[model samples]
Target: MNRAINCHVGCRCSHLTIEVSHGSYRNFTQRFVKAVVNTYKDLIEWPKNEHRVAEIKNGFMYGEGRNAWGLPAVGALDGKNFVIESETVHAEDWRDCKGNFSMKLMAVCDDKSKFTYISAGNSGRSHDAAAFNLSEIATVAMENHGEYFPLDGYILADSAYPLSHYIIVPYPASEVLGRSGGASAKKKFNKIHSSTRKAVERAFGILVSGRRFVSKHIYIKDTGDIVGIIIAYYILHNLCIEMNDPVLEEDNDETSNVDVARPDSFIQSVNSTAYQNGRIRRHSINPYFPSQQ
Candidate 1:
């Protein structure tokens, strides 16, 4: 096999047995990715059926060979940044907080680390919450929560996302510590949330570490191409999961844990009715998890 093509497919090719031009390789990869994405896009859809929903919920509760968190969640939500070449139109918009020119990929994954929902091509500068709020899933979730998140179930998200009827966020660490000054019900809940939410992070790790095209800085100038390539890899990731491919050891350690900065205030405060409802729901479940010493 050609060395460049072999390496591009995530197999370590040590020797250059055949020379392949960069342009030719890139064009080939683009065509290959487009074909894969178009043929298998349905593999990365949100769970809608009762059986699938129950399976995802069970996966979350007993994931990583651990006990159930007892929370009704179908998926874990998170965002990731994919580095890209800086020479593009509106390049400044892609500059993230860490000074990398990249694009944001928001996703929700099941307990088995398979991507169930994905929204790519957002500016890296956009907050995770903002990116999610603009996603089709969020729009549909807001319009009819039961249609997506049935039986009052919600997605488990980190603090970067806002709490809503369809999404549940962990209690802010600062607020949790300040309220009790030590271990408490909220603190225990955060621990469980983090444990369960790590599934989404692991899903991203599998994508980045398994695909050489995604792990390296993409040199594409067009944002559309970049988005397509990323989404194609996500589709491939789901296919790999379906095949029960063994996850690489390094993938577990490749999880990204960037801290998000929150906004000072909201323009429409009344919209917080949902936030308050989320808080109430969280509090209602707090008693179920007794704090331990």
Candidate 2:
């Protein structure tokens, strides 16, 4: 792969490829190096976040994991883990709570299962909301991009995220349903929500499956760079899906429930909760497409 990229740059084909030397990778082309470095500087340094923010502006609608915004859509947020040899005593202890105490990557995904925004590693023990609350996605979205996708609405999530005007979380405990509010909420869910918000699962599955990212053989001085490489893999994965590529393999980690998301239970609780709450109601405003609707 390195040889291909290197040779592509070296031979100077009309195909126009750019490379960026980051972390351990170097020796692409001068154009590639400068382009990638500038891109990296923009994303991580320049304005503190130009790459992902610009990506969202170009096509990565923050809340819509679908074709674009204003369509049937929902973004899914979840954390991904990578086990490298531990970091510093302080940082190591932070991630170390996970038995392996390895580094973790948290990200928000579009419905198509592409990363819309990613957060750098927090301790493996950090909660989803804690990581989310500190993220730059919302702040960046709020920047000047006229007529942009509304950062003003809700997105479906597993019970892990907090329910708010901009986010929807499943019933905390299904048992709480069967009461008046519970039954009503379940009815609303039937009308406007579903358990098949499956993009996050598919994304993680592809990462661990195709990239084979679950093993541990990495030596680490800076595991964050390794995390970036994994994310780059996902970008290529999404690009493959976008390019309509039919060549890909299923994730072999069928038994690896590292995410611990229970979509079945989540949906079941929505229904059960409505049964307990009151009467079911229809969605006044749908978030899906006409076909999906």
Candidate 3:
């Protein structure tokens, strides 16, 4: 953890270099890794929610959300890339059909846009909902003592997450997922209500837009360690988010200059079925407000 903190603050520590360097894992050997990981994980102290909330509120507003629980919380949950070092043999198949198959890391940030929970350890082949099913937030509440979040607290998520009684789905099925109702106006009303629930996307977007969550230069070979690194980066990213640190953002217009997503190949064109389905899916997302939820 000290290594992570030091590396983040420009200490240029050896841990960061060794972490990504070739054959570094071999240096520690597998047994050493397990001991080190257990030691570091045990020592890790994720900051409290109140401290994070205070820092985040100083920089940004909930945008469209209310001060629920008296915190300017920004709802967060994201599907992000977890770059790997290349796999040796089966790398080709693990590669995303569009490109490389980085592990997918999902997380839930709070109203201040700080990470309250992060769920890791998913293969890139998994869909967003598959990961959501194994969410830490859902299971952790039952195991840990005391109520972690306010009893009146709730969350909003995209359709990719399972609709639960605790967290609300902001967009109705059709508007969010392009799955229309079976001839009910009630569905449309639900859709209207859900449109405002998009603060999560914006929160996620800001994280990814900055290099802290996504390194501009990524090349992976699927190291077993990369998964933790990816997750650690997400946790670190949210720390930066909570800090509201000024980071150099990528210019999407100049995305060409940065490392392109490492798919073995680009998605050349929309398949006939995809083209049809994609249009329908996109049509459902806020035709009225491109920037709105």
Each candidate: RMSD: 4.2, 10.4, 11.1
Query: After superposing candidate 2, which stretches have Cα over 4 Å from the reference?
Result: 1-71, 138-148, 151-153, 174-176, 179-194, 214-217, 247-293
**Model 3 lDDT at residue 245:** 83
Ranking by lDDT: 1, 2, 3
- Candidate 1's TM-score: 0.85
lDDT of 1 by residue, 127-199 (tens): 8878988998777766777778776678888777877667777776454555564346777777777778888
Scored by CA lDDT, what does every candidate get?
0.74, 0.47, 0.45
Predicted candidate 3 versus true structure: per-residue lDDT over 143-167, tens digit per residue: 3413443332334555455443333
For residues 208-263, what per-residue lDDT tens digits would candidate 2 score against the true structure?
Answer: 66654343433434655555555455556656666767645446553224223334
TM-score of 2: 0.57
Clash count, predicted structure 3: 18
Instruction: Give each model a TM-score.
Output: 0.85, 0.57, 0.52
- State the local distance difference test value for candidate 1: 0.74
Candidate 2, overall lDDT? 0.47
Per-residue lDDT of 10 in model 3: 30
